[model samples]
Target: MAKITAAEVNKLRKSTGAGMMDCKNALVEADGDFDKAVEILRKKGQKVAAKRADRESSEGAVIAKVNDSNAKGVIVSLNCETDFVAKNEKFVELANDIAELALNCNSKEELLDAELNGLKVSEKLIEQTGVIGEKIEIGDFRTLEAPFVGSYIHAGNKIATLVGLSAQVEGAETAAKDVAMQAAAMNPVALDEAGVDQETIDKEIEIAKDQLRAEGKPEEMLENIAKGKLKRFFKDNTLVNQDFIKDSKQSVAQYVKSVNKDLTIVGFERVALS
Candidate 1:
């Protein structure tokens, strides 16, 4: 067996972006060979990750990253079995790192396969399971690259929202962010009343009619009353129909129209714990 020195471990750590202890262990296992140590750590991390695959990961952090130009962004949910492990500094760091990669990569599969400090991301997560002492998994990875994109993460680190806007305004980024925050808070299901599915509307109308009948309302007026209630339901659940959080006097659609006639919300994503 070859001796592994502190300098060799430090060199490997610098090369791999791995923890000090991990680098040292890899160096020992590789008999002081730098290239061989890298391979050893990569394989070990994967094996460790697999061993903890069945562990439940209910708690974790949701992280989002936007480019300096605000043209591209990524959101990711990294999960762990315990809230205690989810709150760990290392776990948060890993989440952020994966989010950054998600922004650069096109798909979740690509992001998972991407290299992280030399080892594949999935392998790194597995490797982390050994150190973190919990089952860690990448829950969700979503990337949005649009003309205008913004994101918001609620205070608890559990909820995250991303919004994409299409507009011809100079400071659209700020507006988009505000909209994203609204989505995070209010959780609108669709961009407008028209965007809500007809089936859902029909179901809601049926429910309203049932409630009205239970209250002994006149059967003749039930359909009319249900229709009226459906309008309010659309107002509550649609992004454009809902009142703007900043100003209750006007709906979000009206607010957007006031700012720019051409401004339109393309899409949005909201993520929270199950």
Candidate 2:
């Protein structure tokens, strides 16, 4: 075995972000070869990742990123086993990196396989799992694209949202972000009544009818009353129809229109980490 100097160990530590002791052990195992030592550390991470595969990673960072043109956006969550790891600066930075990369990835599988900082994103996650001694993985991921896009990340990185606009009109950024914040706060089930699935609509109508029947309404009145109640449900549950959180007098659609008469909401996505 080659002599492993303290300087060699520190070099490995600096490169891999491993602890001094772990770096030293890796150097010893690799006979003081820097590249070999780095590989050894990563293999250790893979083993740790395998062992923790079943652990629930409920805590981590939620990040939202938009493209340079503001024509696209993505929200991504990096999951870990504890809040301690979630709050780590490095962990948050990794989440931000992933979110930036995710702005181009259309699916979770692509994001995991995409190269990041010379390492596959999956490999990086495995490496961090070993270093942090906890499970680490990518959780929620969503992408939205339109003529204009805006994003919001709630305080504490607990929630992230993206909203797309039909046109890139004046004040579109603030309007889109306002709606994105509303999404992070309200969590509408769909962008509009049209977006709600027929099954969900039927279920809501049936539920309303049941409630009205229990209230002693005549059977003949049940259909119309239930229809009216279903409209209320849409107003409360859909994004555009819902009252603007900032000004309840106007709906979200109205608020965006107020920003620019030509601007319209195209789509939206929200990811939450509880």
Candidate 3:
């Protein structure tokens, strides 16, 4: 067997981002061939990734990034097998890098296929699983674009929100942030009642009617009671109707109006990692 020198191992480590011992072992396995050593490391990563394929990766970080003009933003969750790995500095940095890539991607698949250094993002994720000795993958990816956009990443990187405004104005940025924070707190189902899907509306109304019938309410009044409950649902579950987190006295719509009468929340996405 050929001996692997320190220079060769260092070169492999630099190229593959693997630990010193792993690089040296790969070099020895590959007989000091750099390309073969890289391939060996990748295969190792693949093996480790496959071994943990069934593992739950619910613990990770949520990251948000906006474009230079703030007209576009993305919120992403990078998940790992354990909370200890989730809080790892390198793990957090990897998630941020993927979020940065999302700013340029049109879809989650594009972001996964995008390259980081010389490896595809998906491959890097597998590589990371090998390094961290756990399962790691992209859990969620969401994006928004409008005239103006702002993103907020909450403490511990557990929740991230992105909000878009109708038009850019003096207070639009602040308003956008406020709306984003509201999103993080309220977890609204839609931007407004109009944006709520018909299926969801139907389901809510059906559930309300069922409850009313169970309560032995008169049949003739069931429709009216369901309609009223639906209205209350919109008020509680939609962004525009929900009370603002900063000042509960006003609805989010009114709070937005106070920022700038012309400003409105055009779109939003909330991502959570648990």
Candidate 4:
């Protein structure tokens, strides 16, 4: 058996980001073959990943990245098993890197299959799971493309938002930013009443009517009361109807109009740790 020198162990550790003992063990197992030792370490990572396949990764980092032209953006959550690993500098960097790649990817699957330093993102994640001794993976991913895009990553990286606008106006960027922050705060269900699906609208109306009927309202009055309640629901739950965070006196739609007459939200995406 070839002796595993400290120099070889340290070299493998630097190359693979594995623990010293693991690297030494791999080197010894591979009979001091550098490539074989690296492969062994990766196999160990794969085993760890498989074992933790059912583990829930609820904590990590959220990252949002926009293109140089501001016409496209991407947001993603890189998750881990613990807050300690979530706050690691390297973990955050991994999230940022994946988000940057997501700017060009149309879907989460594509982003995972994307390559990083000759290794697919999914493979890198498994490798990271092994290095960190926990389940690490991308929890969510979304992208926005429009005439203008604005993105925000809230404090602690627990939340991220991306807003798309129909027109690129002078103040459109600021309006987009305000709307993104609004999304982070309010968690709106839809952009407007029109965007609310028929199923959800019907469900809300039914729920409202049931409550009104249970309160002894007349059957004839129940429909009208439910309609009124639905309107209130729209006002409170829709993005455009919700009061602006900065100025509660006006709706988000009114605030956007004040910024630029033609600027309007085309689409938006929000991701949270939970």
Candidate 5:
């Protein structure tokens, strides 16, 4: 058997981010050939990741990445069964690596199929499942691309949001980030009141009237009561109608208008616990 040296083990550790013992084992198993050792470790890790495929992954992390120039960004939710595994360094690194992969991917399906450090994402997930001993899965993957985009991850990995701005301003990044934060907190259904469909509004109005009637409100006051309730519905569901998180004195739309009239929110996305 070829002798494996400390230098070779350190090199493998640096190259693969595997533990010292894992690197040493691979080196010894590969007869001290560096490249062969890496391959062996990768294959072994993959097998390990695959063994835990069916374990439920209910807890994990949401990771986001932006280009160095801040032109594009992506967010992804990588889930695992236990909070302990979710907080593991390996899992967090995997989540970040996947989010970076998402920046180049146009769709979730494409992202899932894309290669991560030479392995397909699904393969990596399976490998991670084996290592983490949980059924880890990629819950959500979203990317935002524009002249400029910003992202925010709320407390823990419970929520993630991304926002794209049309025109750049002095504090545009912060503003866009605040918008994403609002989306995370408010859980808005539409960008603005106009974006809410008539059918949905009508249904909500009907539900409101039914509840009010159940309470024995006077028939003549039904229209006024329903209108009032509809306004509340808009406040709850519309992005523009939501109170700005930084300052609740104004709605998000009003806050944006105060920032720049030309700044239109081209698009936004939010992912949270289902």
Candidate 6:
């Protein structure tokens, strides 16, 4: 049997982010062969991942990152089984690193296949499951691209948002960030009235009609009254039409226009842990 030194154990622990004891055990099991020890730890991760396949991983970090030019951004949620693991400094760091990598990828599938520290993200998540002793996975992956982009992450990493603008104006960063914060706080259902799906529109109208009927509104006026209520829904639930949280006197669209007449909110993406 090969004698495992403390240096060997620390090296494996550093490389795998596994606990010192786990690394030492893997090293011992592998007869002090570093490569074999890594394999053993990875196999442990696979076993843990498969065993916890049905576990709920609703708690994690929501991270947002943008490219150097600020023309593109992404929000990624690195989910774990508990808030304790989610808030771990190393876990959040991994999430931020993955978010940075995600800024270059178009979709979750691509991001998973992308390599991080010589390991594919999907593999890293599996490895982390063993290290964390909990399910670790990506819950949300969203991207936005425009002439300019900005992002915001709410306290506790509960919410993350990205906003894109029509042009890279003077205040584009500030405008985009403000809109992103608005998205995080207001939780708009759609970017605009036009963006709201017909199904949702119908449902809101139907709900309004029922409420009005309960109030004993004349049945003949139901259609018009429902339309009015739908308009109100648009005003409150859509990003551009919603009242600006900072200044209730104006809508989000107006606030963006005030920054620069040519600046417009082209798109946005939001991701939350819940």
Best by lDDT: 6
Cα lDDT of model 3 overall? 0.90
- Cα lDDT of all candidates, in order? 0.81, 0.91, 0.90, 0.90, 0.80, 0.94
lDDT tens digits, residues 16-57, model 6? 999999999999999999999999999999999999999999
Q: Report how far residue 170 has shifted in candidate 3, in Å.
A: 0.8
Give candidate 6 regions above 4 Å deviation: none
The CA lDDT at 105 in model 6 is 95
Candidate 6 residue-wise lDDT at 186: 94
- lDDT by residue for model 1 (48-159), tens: 6777777778899998788877777788999988888778787788888888878778887898899987778877877676556678888887777667888898876798
Candidate 3, which segments miss by more than 4 Å at Cα?
A: 1-11
Q: Write the per-residue lDDT of candidate 4 for residues 1-274, one digit (tens) a residue.
A: 9998999999888777788999989998999999999889888889999999999999999999999999999998999999999898888988898888888899989999999866899988988788888999888888889999998889999999999998888998889989999999999999889989999999999999899988999999988889999999999999989999999999998998898887788888999998
Candidate 5 local lDDT, 1-274, one digit each (tens): 9988888888877666677898898888888888898778767766765666566666889877778766788888998778887778877888888888888888888988999877788767765553444677888777777767888888777688888887778778888888988998889988877888999999998998899999999888988899999999999788878888899999887787788877777777787755
Top TM-score model: 6
Residue pairs with colliding backbones in model 2 are none
Better of 1 and 6 by lDDT: 6
User: Which candidate would rank higher by TM-score, 4 or 6?
Assistant: 6
lDDT of 2 by residue, 1-274 (tens): 8998989988877667789999999988988888888899999999999999999999989999999999989889999999988999888988998988998899999999998877899998988888889999999988888999999999888899999999988899889889999998999999998999999999999999899989999999999999999999999999999999999999999999899887889899999988
TM per candidate: 0.85, 0.95, 0.93, 0.93, 0.82, 0.98
Clashing pairs in 5: 49-126, 49-127, 49-130, 55-135, 57-80, 57-81, 58-80, 58-81
Candidate 5 versus the native: TM-score?
Answer: 0.82
Candidates 2 and 6 compared: the better one by lDDT is 6
Span of ten consecutive residues with least summed lDDT in model 6: 260-269
Clashes of 6: 0
